[model samples]
Target: MKIGFIGLGVMGARMVKRFLEAGHEVFVFNRTPEKAEFLVKLGALRAKDIPSLAEQSDVVCSCLSMPEDSIKVFLDGVIPHAKSGTICLDFSTVGVDTSRIIYQKAREKGIDYLDTPVSGGPEGVENGTLTIMVGGEKEAYERVRSLLNSLGEKIEYLGGTGSGSIAKLINQYLVAVHSIAASEAMVAGAAFGLDSEQLYKLLKLSYGQSRMLERHMEQYVLDRNFEPGGAVKYVHKDVKLANQLFEQAGLTETLGKLAENSFSQAMSIGLSDLDMSAVIKPLEDKSGVVVKK
Candidate 1:
């Protein structure tokens, strides 16, 4: 299949490589021309701009950073140039309202738009094991199932339009809360003089275990390797979006708000570029104990 991909950031670049390795013809564009150039050398075609890429693709897939960016790309770059019947999939974590607005605009132009937010971070992208939550027309979803399968281990088609965004927000809410809880638990355990590695093993087998504990704590936090798997800044955006959903739904407060504040503090202290596990640093600073092996 001829696929046009926009946004070549951490996850986007890896996904484009997956498509290329699977023998699909890929056309790629990025704000940074150098990122697109790197993909071009790996057998993907370099698109001068989004419109040109949309014009030539059977399926247009975008993994942008912000909802505003997704809006601009579809409204200004895609809808104008993409042929009728082109399927557009947005894999960004965006608000439900934003996804629905874009969906309506795409429908007006006869383009099928799916808010297909993904989980599993960059590791998932590299391993072809992402969990893709899709929301759009059933027929349109079936059309891209094979391609989605190539990129993920789990692909679920929710109801319509913004359903996928809602699902992804819920997923990210849990991720944020769990990541914060995991950090707190690990930091507390370390402060109490327990071996970090031993405590992690016990937590894994206990009721307190969570995926965040495994990914954020076991893999990165305990080792003190705060390299970016999913950065704090991006997770901050996602949690804030989740908080917006809570506010719109008339909820007084959510645990996501707490995670948002924690991530915000991490960012204020200059930890935005580090891994989401770096949220532990502020706690470490306050307690004077390192949650390391």
Candidate 2:
């Protein structure tokens, strides 16, 4: 498949590489050229911009940051120059409303569009084990399934238009809550002088285990490195979206509210660029008990 990939951030960079490794001819672009340059060296042609990318590809995939970024890239760049019948897949975790709007707009232009957000982060991308939840026309999804298989271990057709976004929102909600809950648990352990390492191993063997718990245990409990698996700013956006979704549904989520507040507070303390596990920082400040070394 001749594919155009836009947005070469952490996840995007790895995803493009996976496609290339799968023997796809990949044309790549990024808002920051340096990131894409490395992939360019690996045989990805550099697009002058998204329009050029769209003009020369059968399929286009994006893994941008926010809703606004996705809109800007597709609207200002790809949509204008996309050939009729090109399939555009967005792997960005964006809002359901925005996904519907993009789907409608893409169809109007004779392009096939899919909201195909992913979970499992950079490690997942590298391992080709990311779980992809796709929402689009069933025909479009079937057409792109092979290409998607190159990048994901598990791919599910999640329905139409905004359905993938809805699924992604729910996924992010749990990610935020679990990560913060893990932080609180670690803080509790510290207060009781329980060995943090021992407790992590015990929890992993117990029902308290989760992907976020294992991921955080790497830096927070073990090495104390706060780099981005999922960044602080990104989780802040997801939590805010979850709150909006809850309000729109006329529902209340007190626990979700607390998780949002915890991540929001972490962002407030200038930890926005750090890993999502840095949510532990605010709780650390409040309790005066840091989680291990």
Candidate 3:
């Protein structure tokens, strides 16, 4: 397939690599241009602009950073310029309304749009093991199922447009909540003079264990590696969007709001660039205890 890709951020850049590795003819573009250099070195063509990419490709894939970026790229760029019957796969995690609006707009143009939000971080991207949540027309999804297989091992097709983003936001909501809870438990243990390592080990085999607990404690928190896998600011945006989703669904926004605030607090104090596990930092500061081995 001839693939046009945009947004060359940490995960996006790597996903383009996957496309290239799978023997696809790839066109790469990023706002910065320089971010496409590595892929360019590996035989991917550079798109001078979004219109050029849209004009040249059979499939237009995007993995943008923000909801606004996704909208402007598709609404102003791809949807207007791309030919009919193009399949646009979006791996960004914008909310339901954003996805559905774009999906409808693309459908009107005869371009099939799939809101294909993904999880599993950079590791997932590189290893092609990401859990992909796909939402759009079932026929459209089937057409690109083979292409998607090159990027993700676990591809789940949800019902319709926006379903994927809805599911992704819900996943992120718990990711935020569980991150905080895990951090608190570890910190609380440390504050009371328990061994952080031993406590984490205990939690691993107990009912209190969670994937977030294992991820933070083993990979990030214990190693004191605050470098982002998924950053605080992104999680804040996701949980905030998730909170809005619940509110729109007529549920009271309680835990979601609190998680959003917690991540916001991480953002306000210059921890936004750190890993989501750094949500623990504020609590650590308050308790004067670190959750390191």
Which candidate leads in lDDT? 3
lDDT of 2 by residue, 1-293 (tens): 78999989899999999998989999998878889778988988998888889999999999989999888888888888999999999999999888988888889999998999999888799988999999999999999999989888999998989888988898898899898899999888877888888888899999999988888986555677887778988998997797788788887855779888888888888999999998888887777887764
Clashing pairs in 3: none
Quick one: ranking by lDDT, best first?
3, 1, 2
User: Pairs clashing in candidate 2?
Assistant: none
**Comparing 2 and 3 by TM-score, which wins?**
3
Q: In candidate 1, what are the lDDT values of residues 59-114, reduced to their tens digit? A: 99999988999999999999899999999999999999889988899999999999
Q: What TM-score would every model get versus the actual structure?
A: 0.97, 0.97, 0.98
Judge candidate 3 against the unseen true structure and give its global Cα lDDT, from 0 to 1.
0.93
Listed per candidate, the RMSD to the true structure in angstroms reads: 1.2, 1.2, 0.9
Which regions of candidate 2 deviate over 4 angstroms?
none
Worst 10 residues of 1 by lDDT: 215-224
